[model samples]
Target: MNRVWLPVVAVQGLWLRSTLRLASAPGGGVSGTVPGPAAEPLRLAVLGDSTAAGCGVTGDEEAFAASLAREVAARAGRPVAWQAVGQFGATSRRIRFRLVPRLDDDLDLVVLLAGANDVLAGRGPDLWREDLTGILAGLADRAHRVAIAGIPPFIRFPAIPATLARHLGERAAALDAVTREVCRQSARTTTFLEQPAGTPPADFFSTDRFHPSTHGYRLWAQDVAAQLIPDQPAP
Candidate 1:
């Protein structure tokens, strides 16, 4: 079975509500209020692939955008309105083509979590770097605070084919390198979130082992929140 592109069933909405509740709990330490202008909620935009869209997770709330918004709001002491723009099989190239133009200048923060599809498509590092650079440049030029999430390790998942899995693993490393280089070159353009090693595939992924589960989005949201709020460290 060529399960490379198989779509994982979206989880139920109840799962999202439950996850949000847990993430919002005081013990969870996920909530943080963003203190700034009382002028409406801070607008946050997320762009990427299935992970960014919370494909494996059920409902929008279970996605990273929702969790991050909640956390940022709690910590920053302000309200946040999160907008997610993602596609299941999107790559960096596709993001450049489809998602970039839709971004609003009013967006306070932009989170980009892409490149896995580019890896699957066998895109070269140079091309990945080009597209990512252009994306970051566009955002920076507009004075939007941006953060680039590293591609998580996919080879550890059991559902993928061995050959494709191996390729993805190598590609992830290459993409990470290019991402770092771009971040260094871009002037205060994009912050890089390094994917932590040893994160169990099950904890971070859904049943299909491709998209992130609710837990996975939480983890990604934590990383994003840390970047947005330097005072708080991501666990």
Candidate 2:
């Protein structure tokens, strides 16, 4: 099926790339604090690609990284100090090599929002699994806990044409399967997080119809918060 759709997907992808302008990443320091009464902050680092960089939103505060920090802080009843380390067209291999080196040690949490580029580029699951394993191994030395954000739903994004989206979505699924196994094997310090169920795709996307909007960020944060701080009290 992918062979049948590959040519069409490629043509449509080229057209979309030429026609749609990529959104700019939010400016300023990618680090911030979600205010709360707790004296100490739960440190967080979000590492990955464009979505991790909060490309769809204009400001850093409106991005999903901030939302996730707030959600975690509110639930944990502690302030959250967070930083989003991301690039526009980064792959899992880049994340393992480039971004992981940028993190500080003894952090509370680290979440990886990778795999979209890997899937879209049609990279094989073996390469993805290898990169992910390396990333996790490095992250283990940096943070106490790590969460792997599952691959994005390419088929649901309005910006993606149907044929191309289907192929990408299947690829995403394959990558995610590898991610899940990696997380499970590294279960001592890692876990995988999925997209929030019941989220409306129309509202979740931004003007580009590819990256996440502010609403999407909040929804995603809430879902992540639940998983990341399952034992923490609700705010």
Candidate 3:
């Protein structure tokens, strides 16, 4: 089946600057006055699994976080500093263990792209929800604006057993539902992007068929940038 995925929307450049200013006030570590003519870049924090870490991709530029930073800089007319905390095979549980203690209130935006590994590991949906909730709460306590990317359908990928693909796809959909509910309940965050299931596989993924290829990361970056950037005309 041909699945039609939503094209990512373009965001306004100023949004990045505003987010940065909020994250780096006088009280916080971020310093220097917000740029007037030249908008300051946003400070983005990404936390999650191998995908967020750019596992299949070769270099940093190919990583979603890095590509996002570049896109924001290009459109925002300023620089962006993105901090990514990702681990291969990391589940929401492991991410909570690693990222919670390190969080600071100075972060402008936080992206939570996770849960695939959890499903692959046969983790329960309730457990995934619990861990994800904890992570969101922690970020809120630190006073950061957040966005959660829905777990895309993985069944279409070249990897994984065809029998397992259907099951995995269902699991991913379940996780996406939970994520949507969590984002709805949380006032501090938003779920601005959704990568739908059943889309034709992109060549951007790596040989493992698990992680994004440079092209894949770039497409992901475009999706993210559409949401994170301020209002820009649709492409």
Off by over 4 Å in 3: 1-37, 103-105, 196-202, 230-235
* C-alpha lDDT of residue 119 in model 2: 82
Query: What TM-score quantifies how close candidate 3 is to the native fold?
Result: 0.76
TM-score of each: 0.76, 0.92, 0.76
lDDT scores in order: 0.69, 0.84, 0.66
How do all the candidates rank in terms of TM-score, highest first?
2, 3, 1
Best by lDDT: 2
Among all windows of 10 consecutive residues in model 3, the one with the lowest summed lDDT is: 21-30
Instruction: Say what the RMSD of model 1 is.
Output: 9.2
Off by over 4 Å in 1: 1-40, 141-143, 161-164, 201-203, 232-235
Model 2 sits at a Cα RMSD from the real structure of: 2.3
Better of 1 and 3 by TM-score: 3
* Model with the higher lDDT, candidate 2 or 3: 2
RMSD for each of the candidates: 9.2, 2.3, 12.7
User: Whose lDDT is higher: candidate 1's or candidate 2's?
Assistant: 2
**Candidate 2 stretches greater than 4 Å from native:** 27-29, 199-201, 231-235
Model 1 gets an lDDT of: 0.69
